[model samples]
Target chain A: MKSEARKPFSKDIIHIENIDQVCNDIIAKLKMDVTKNLQRRGAIVGISGGIDSSVCLALSAKAFGSKNVLGIMLPEQDSSDDSRHLAEKLAATYGVSTLIEDITKALDGFGCYERRDEAILRVIPDFDKKVDKAKIEIKQNIAENIPAIFSITVIKPNGDVVSKLLPAREYLQIVASTNFKQRSRMSMLYYHAERMHYAVIGTPNKHEVEQGFFVKYGDGGADVMPIGHFYKTQVYQLAKHLGVPQEIIDRTPTTDTYTAEQSQEDFFYQMPFESMDLIWYGWENNYPAEEVGKVMGKTTKEIENIYKSFERKRKTTEYLRMKPIF
Target chain B: MKSKNDVKTEIKKYILEASLSDVKDVEDDALIFENGLLDSMGLLFLIEFLGETFEVEVNDDELNPKNFESINNIVSFVNNKLSVKV
Candidate 1:
């Protein structure tokens, strides 16, 4: 396909050539957003020694400054040594403050017991029953079965006393706990930003933002998304351009929820990043999942599923993409 | 007989369902957040689910971390909130 096959989302031109202009415009808008909304500048980032976060941190450091940036590192107990090392290394290199908190403690404290590690068919919930569907994952033995993985935590109420978790199931209980961690971090980040006077920097990319991949009010939640529009491929490229370590470039990305062996794709039925990325880029670019999947030689069902999910998320994340509600 | 027990059992069923960690033997004092247990928001969602499900209202102050640290705490907190609301 030709480069021109897909047109830009808008004529606003948030391109690399004018990155500085775009960033400045974004900051001005954020400042204005805060002023108009009567909010403060606070940014929280889950810097998982990964390319996306590395790039996001670097850019955020420039946009806001090192002091305004809060780098949260949540590693599953068994997470690869490299990710933690790279995370701390990246933080030290970029001058962003860091927090090394583990989710395992939360797992044990909450009375969790994992039996089955995987599932063939998972329960699907309908909104009618008011059934929180994601909670079903916590029912099985998967909690201990899966190693803790990577994820951003934000807890509310008492941000200082937030809970961490094993990133396993027991959905409502621990997800709320873990989510509280994410939300807590965010809450604290926002509070600190309000106190310190800075905007919150979200690390979502075009792919994740478009896919509705992030849990609502979780990692997907951010006051100012610095790199939401960048594709994952673009992020890696940008990270490399910015001289990010090579190991982070090749390391597998995980939410740091389960054991270190888990990855971001574990819940997605083993979808590969390359495949998911291409399909995601295609859909985001509006190539039509069928057409893009056909080009990629994906199965008809896969294409159909991709289209349905893409459409659903496009609608869901649309609100996020727009200027804040204020 | 079934009124309280049924309510209690059903509540347990739902807690197990809503929780992210497996809910086999959670006690009253289990520290949900510190042990990497139920996140605070997850607890809130569970609380919201309980309130909505049982047609109860939990005051903001009652949603403190202490009440939701374990299954027993959750049950007691819910029962108390529900009874008070009733």
Candidate 2:
């Protein structure tokens, strides 16, 4: 590990200038594409009150008209109450038509919670079903040279929490089970879209889409992706320009599908969004590890390890980004 | 409008393009989902493709595995829906 002191970097890492112009350009492109290519009059976005969805919704409203852009609030048992409230608040603020779809029944129909619990039990032997809560996280240990490891944390009723390393089978089960929520919401979106002759819009940002951080066919399923090109940092810029709610703007990103309040940082990317944006941008641009390390106040070895971790994730989740194999 | 055979060919092309598994010569009667040739996400793409290609509404209820189990099933489903539209 190196000291935290480092020299100034050359330029902005993931910052975008002329935020309004860029935002309007994105909106114009989405509008033109939807009207001409898709031949759809309107767009539908699932609003989680997260920055990504909020930006996408605002763009869609600007592109297709507030009356044409439908904002869907998909909430399940594990979803935070704030998710619905904040999403509704955004829809109202934007004058966009909104609907709520309670996905608890749909997730239950697929036995999502039960399957997830079964997987958790494999890692936490004495994990209580009633009062114990659990969440899974992926971590990279550069010192140990381990690219990725799945870990489970079980919080008992008495406030005792224990963490255990997960085997591949248990990890797979847990992820597959948690993914049911996204798929249920996607199904509901398509149901409404088909009836209304509207197109479904996906809200994945640059990091999630490029780094393979999404569940295939679940949250990844959409007729069009309006914000796939913007980095997480750029998304916040767009959100500010779009007048997204301040509470939504300041909220930390969370998986929100798990029973526990797990952050996207702990669950997937080992670094926070700000650092990740710079690291990923540097890596993608083929900047040397030493240079990136100097810029980010880390050692060259640390930067190299982060690049390795990113590639490992990309390779393992390549299937999510693939076209049907021939 | 294209014939059902043309529709089958189009659907076959989509399955071949969207599936990641090595299914170069998938049988029309083969169970695509059971054989792991297609998945939930693939099904969603197929639904979108069908909706766009046939101009038929594919609702959530029609996303059953039976409707997408094989090329034959997809062809029949599209034809049935198109017939109703006509």
Candidate 3:
């Protein structure tokens, strides 16, 4: 067999040129994965108005027919109103039926807010959960060779902002409490899927899956993940090709789990998806750091540091991707 | 006020307890993270422990993996911070 030539690493390395063919292939795989492999009648997609979920919903509609697909909107108290509005618009555009399951009460019953606020109070003694907004973010860029130091930020009702380095115990507790949102949403998705004899579709992209950005047994639990292989940039391409809502395609991706409005890049990824996608492509394909650095307008050492950061995340989060052992 | 030996012993004890691992032999230069002895969360707890036990502030700039890769590196980094304080 002749050895295949490798393409040069560049900014366009992750671009999907033939989107129609890609969508058709994905639709076929989804149809087979759900109908043949899982014996499911349709797909139940938890739409969040984000690009990845929107694309997944659109593709599910195409795979199982719009009438067979059901979109579930699981929103909590911290969820942005625009998320629900955009999700409704997305479902309407795809002609799929949607169910609004307000998970705020469920999360409240789980003490999600109370526990998370308690942890926040450890770092910010005066943090008032009733009127304050809080979020956690990494302190430095991933391109630097520094350990990621997560910090908590609180905004008071009067526009006063307070930020401090989060201690280990408090950070762990806050994250554990906030994770209820994902686990709750997952349970809701499974309930709808099982009741309707449908498969739950996962909306995680490559970075989310590879970097372990998702919660274990939470958003990570899915009957089928149609877009798990595509990078964030490629997901955008699929969204455009699938006629996803313009507003959704244009909207910045958010964590939506935090009370304060936080971009997905701020909460995780530590960089723009565009840059991350290209650099990850280069690193995964074993391109030299110098070559990637030249194209990215960064030094070779910076590219190396980013690669190291990626490796560290993958190594640390490996547990999230593991299955049960006997 | 603690010696380098004391720093090393404390870090090793923390690593073993935090990891919950059965490995008994933690060498002076063993790569804790690379060897899967501790994880990202464990690293955060270790940072907190070092700061509180040594009474030294770990600046954001000093949070480099190289400074905490091994027991030897952590001892040196703590001593450097202590000397700066002195």
Candidate 4:
């Protein structure tokens, strides 16, 4: 807390000299801090088989050796096959001992927590039963009581049926849930890092920090992100230089935010990355709205509207700047 | 063409194949995680990728954030591994 005294605003202004020095200087100083602060604590980072993490892990394994890093795959049942494949392949490649725990049950385990929660999950099972010849659609909204040992289901009278109320694979809480996965991995990484006096590292890229694309107190929670300063595209170049998998580099990047396979960009901006990246740069560089129109082939008014939409984002980016120094 | 640096360079080539992205000009210091560039699992997979590509190992305890912040950091990390007494 004492070290975090200065709260610098997000820089739309990129200094060439700072850029050159920051990457090395930041990593060296930060690594020393991570290694020294936690003495034996090592690092935990999840690799979703995407560009950023690939870049991050390459560095982590290099810093602490593959023997010290912990790679965990916490995925929901609806997770894409590529998700599992990428995690498994990446882990195998690094010689880092790995663990794959399917948390779909944990998510569904929400029903086991509370009586009302169970009742909410106590929807009409797909079972058919005929009782007393009174065909009341009682199975529609059946309520269930949780008693540790078992769930007691009570049929509702004429209640509207809960139609496929499965937990959202990736709701707004998807980002939060994803962050939870990272935090959970950290929980395990630190356990070993501390036991062995290894340091824990975080994985973040440059664009996200500048635009404030993460959930505050969620993914934002970390010991430190070694790759937090690198841009999204730069991470790819870095990853290539680091020798990640060919499959990973070619895939359309996705957090698999939903069962529908929506990516992070889609989940966050509801737009394709190509378009978003273009607009993001123009907005940050103070590219005139009219100029944007020319490049994007949109009318000036449309570009201005787009600019206005990002105006709030630019201001909000300040909120995600350096942690307060107090 | 057939040296430790070659292997390291090859490993770099594989790692760069990843598909994550950011909204801004993909420069350094843009917050990969914050920008939705990579998630926890993606980070894990990259660890696997490195094992396969570079034949280096990342133990459970050494996955800290400092070493993987950027390309330069990653290169430094790999250099350490290449130099480590196997």
Candidate 5:
């Protein structure tokens, strides 16, 4: 059998052509999207002090003027201590007007933590609600072509931990409850937007949006998604070019959803963002699994499994992309 | 004012508008969230849609997945609320 000729996948394009031009283009589009289409006077963004939100705020300020952009620091009980400070610092640097909305009350009214704790108890019977515990390391049978088996590990008080595969009902309960954070924030943003007649901006990048890393109507709800077309790596480039604070850019990407410190990699994506990006790009372009494995320094089977997981995640989370059943 | 069938039709319309998946032909008894056709946020939208279109208030206690899991369930929920009001 003859080998098929491989198409060139230039990693440089990932760098993107003239980062400044791309930034300007996004700014222009954001302006048009709000002014012409939505007829909104300004933009409201929930700044988590993450690279994505930082870059989004910087772009929005440039697009609609610093005064026109409202940077909201939406911190809940589970949010990190530094998240609010970092968000405030970024807003000050960007000259955007900032407001602090502590959503602890809202989340409590919805019984967010109570419902989430109930799910945790199902997996780890001995878990103490007062003590901080986290769930991680979901293993999937991608190559086996099975419905993905979800497992979560809970860290305990005495440094002992427990891990177990989650039953479907229990997993959904935990996720559904935790989703309150995003939804509550979305509702608050809309309240401000409705009062001021501004548009709510979302900060999800291409990888997060495509991989279903966001909760629907929560973080995923937005009047405008300014950077959804760019990958995580590319967003960093824009961050650097736009002069986002080094500390903000240097800080690692985190879910900040759980009480414990959890990196985005731990919560989602089996691999690091860099590797996931390339493999995702290659897989989308039909690059052979073996060839991608060679580049990523992985065996063919491992690459195939990662590719399969990527596909599985996208298929299962397709509902996030829907409008509503009309 | 709309009838029960009208409420169901409008609810279905909003679900279609909000969902990007191909759930148009799904059965009325189909489990939506379990099958990944709708999620928590989607459920929120469904609740709000029902409240606004049918003029019924959805309390915090009634926000169960079962009530919004299927078209049949939603229709039943709306009918029940309407009867209660009358």
Candidate 6:
């Protein structure tokens, strides 16, 4: 068989050269998808003050008109105050009407906290929910090409910290209970969307959508996802092109679901978005791992390991991307 | 220290219990994860079992999948760690 020539792999491969054109294309698609396909009057976006949501809100405003766009800030007890503040600033910048819905009470009613604490206590017998903050993180690096081992960290009121490997059962329970936060927010978004006859705009980027980084039927539920095609790095590019606030653009992406303050990198993704975007692009395009490693300043073995990790994640989370069974 | 046969027997037993797979179908060289025997969580449980049962420390750096992809590889990894401790 004849050989097929491969495109040269480099860090610049993921860069969006014409960001304006890209943004305009996304806006055009969003307009058609919402107005014609979904039969929605406007767009409703849940703004978290993060780059992805901020960019999505900006796109929605441009596509559906600022007055027609509604930005909802869903803050729970564990959410950082900066998220709400940034979200408010983003809405104001776009001249969009905004609503603040605190889901703490809803989560509390569902026993979200109680159920999570019960599981945490299974790993840490003395874990106190009221006086302690907690977050779960992967202990091993993804480059190891082994199964991820998750450990939960608890911070005491006095600043003492404790961490322990979470068993499978406790880990599942904690994650299931915490997922109520996302599903609740999704329900609230749909409520507002239905009330206003607007499409709910999802904020996940290509990585989150393809890698199954989002909660199924929770944050994953949406009428339209304008930025789902862009990588995390490309999302930042769109944010910059849309004149998103420098502060929000510079802010590190976070899970924002835990009280203990965790970055998306530490919780998942395992590498900086810049490197991850390039590596994923190269892997997806079937470039030799050596070529990708050379550009990313990593060894060929490391690149191969990352490829394996990505494959495993895609396989495991395949069900999340599936549609409801007939 | 336990002999190689004893170490393999214990590891095989734990793999069977953790995976809940039939013993007759599982071979020494069978791929533990690829064959739907153990999952990510099952791997962690096996690591815990190795540490407690054999007093062998499995460091984060030593977590390469090649070292634990199959029952044979896991036996070799555990034996190497046990030898290092001595």
Report candidate 6's interface RMSD in Å. 2.8
**Candidate 5, B11-85: lDDT as tens digits:** 776766677655556667876655556654456456557766787766533544456667788888888999888
DockQ of each: 0.02, 0.01, 0.42, 0.01, 0.02, 0.43
Interface residue Cα RMSD of candidate 2 after superposition: 15.8
By descending TM-score, how would the candidates be arranged? 3, 6, 2, 5, 4, 1
Q: Candidates 1 and 3: which is better by DockQ? A: 3
Tens-place lDDT digits, model 5, residues A35-146: 9999999999999989999999999999999999999999998899888889989999889999999999999999999998888887678778888577655453233322
Better of 4 and 6 by lDDT: 6
Best by DockQ: 6
TM-score for candidate 2, residues paired by index = 0.76
- What TM-score, computed on C-alpha atoms, does each candidate reach? 0.52, 0.76, 0.92, 0.52, 0.75, 0.89
Per-model clash counts, in order, read: 68, 5, 0, 94, 18, 0
The fraction of reference interface contacts (C-alpha pairs within 8 A across chains A and B) present in each candidate is 0.00, 0.00, 0.34, 0.00, 0.00, 0.50
Q: Can you give the lDDT of residue A141 in candidate 4?
A: 10
What is the per-residue lDDT of model 2 for residues B34-64, given as tens digits with 9 covering 90 to 100?
5556643455456668867888665434544
User: What is the CAPRI rating of model 1's predicted complex?
Assistant: incorrect
Per-residue lDDT over A1-326 for candidate 1, one digit per residue giving the tens place of the 0 to 100 score: 55576553331222256545655665565446544664655455677787777877776666557776778776544346677789888888778898766755554444332211112012121111121112121111111211112221222233332222222233334445444445544555565556667666677777677755565666666776766777666567567666677778888776554332345665432356656666665655566545665666766556655554445445535664565566
Q: What's the lDDT for all of these models? A: 0.54, 0.80, 0.88, 0.52, 0.79, 0.88
DockQ of 6: 0.43
Rate residue A26 of model 6 by lDDT.
92
Give per-model CA RMSD. Answer: 16.1, 17.0, 2.7, 24.9, 12.6, 3.3
At residue A64, candidate 3 shows an lDDT of 92
Residue B79, candidate 2: Cα error in Å is 64
Among the candidates, what TM-score does chain A have in each? 0.61, 0.94, 0.98, 0.63, 0.93, 0.97
- Residue-wise lDDT of candidate 2 within A64-124, one digit each (tens)? 8899989999999889888988998899888998998899998889999999998888767
Q: Write the per-residue lDDT of candidate 3 for residues A1-326, one digit (tens) a residue.
A: 12147777778878998889999999999999999999999999999999999999999999999999999999989999999999999999999999999999999999999999999998899999899999998877797654576889999999999988778889989999999999999999999998999999999999999999999989999988899999999999998889998999999999999999899999888999999999998887788899999999999999998987888888878889999988
